[model samples]
Target: MILWFLGLMVVGLYLSFIMMRRSLKRSALIIVFGIGVVGSLLLITLNDNAHFGMVKRTTTNEQTIYTASPNVQMPMLLKQPAGTADKHAVYIYKTDPKKKAVHTKADLAVRNEISRTADTTASLTSQTTRWEYQNGFYGALFNHEGAGQFVSQRNQLAIPKDWFILTTTQAKRLSAKLKVLQHPTAQQKAALATKVKAKAAELVKAEPELATDQTTLMKQAQKAVQQQLIQQAVQDVQQHK
Candidate 1:
């Protein structure tokens, strides 16, 4: 419908330009230029490379690069951990009326558990899913207690086949380990610290306000609480370890 409307508008505009061209000598160039600009805008609107707001922006070297949105471009199933294919079912369940788009991160654990328990169920087979607005959970049910299975179309990425379950202390230890891995010896650590400090100084030179407190320590503490709930993934090798 939108395409048809845009097409009609373009046709009308072109005809008007043609009439103007006849009235004004050598105005053919103006009409052609106007058509080209309009055509380009229409093409961009019809096939947006940004994938309809699914793309996210990541920054590097003062430039932004857009990456496709996982849920919009890729099948929902591809996001699942491997081998959990049999255990997890992805679906668009009925959303609660009171809460709009309130599928909190905590719900992911519940969804995982549900899939694990209902693995034997006939409907809980696939991992990839594409529940259109008409077929999604909210569309199916007006209230909250609605849920369904999600399946994958294909494996998206090669993730480690096993799981790594990290305790709070273990995660903290790994964070320290990551720092040490960057510098095996005290001498190397000192050198890296100096290099990092220099880089930080350069960044502050470019963006002087970065040195100021944009977020308070309390906000950092709150974020730490949320981070504690997440577990580091284990790879295929770690499964047998």
Candidate 2:
């Protein structure tokens, strides 16, 4: 859109020179010159506020959320920053269980929202506001300068019930306490290991394909064992109190 204004301004200058050489003999040049000046100012005004030559479009994308046990359908760990509680922050998650975590794009013009879903799928819906030419004439005139320029964008993410949202600050502070709660004595470890193996067998029996996948089965079993240990720790603490 700015290019349209600048091009008109340049044409207006060229017309001024032609009018000077012709010494006002070509009266038709006056109308052409007037058009050039008016068109330039009109484009400038439109680009400034009205944004007549542009449109906003939206798109959506859905991806699988990584879990502790992919085959067994374990809870997902969604990491966020401390600042996220007050304002929008970057989200880090993995698309696959074995893949590295991916961070969302952080920018001033970018906004983010989150919604909860009943199932386990994660989705990101992006609404981008860019300067798209309304017609072929505007497309040609403003094609070279800032064509398809980004105005703003908004991302809406759908959260699932299986997601365990954790803030970085909270995770750091609770690191030691969580270790204490999850840790077990030698005897406890022996017993917990037996329970975990039994749990793995039970889950595999329910989903037969996990019998060959050691990693997912082990993760699921370990997670269940850790949760039980944490609950036992809390009970012991209450009893002592």
lDDT of each structure? 0.35, 0.64
Task: Please provide, for model 1 over 1-241, each residue's C-alpha lDDT reduced to its tens digit, 9 standing for 90 to 100.
Answer: 3344445656666666665545554365556656655765664453343222122222212111111112222111112232333354332211332332211122233333222122211122223343222334333232211122222232112112222323223334544544455445888557645655555565556667656743443344333332332222222212321
Estimate the TM-score for candidate 1.
Answer: 0.21
The segments of candidate 2 whose C-alpha lies over 4 angstroms from its true place after superposition are 1-24, 27-31, 67-79, 82-85, 107-111, 151-154, 173-178, 185-225, 228-241
How many backbone clashes does every candidate have? 17, 0
- Model 2 is weakest, by summed lDDT over 10 consecutive residues, at 67-76
Q: Best candidate, TM-score-wise?
A: 2
The deviation in Å at residue 183 for candidate 1 is 62
lDDT of 2 by residue, 9-127 (tens): 56766767564666554455666766777777777677557666666654455556554323233344444542535566766666665876676666668777777889667766667
- Every model's TM-score: 0.21, 0.58
**Worst-scoring 10-residue span by lDDT in model 1:** 60-69
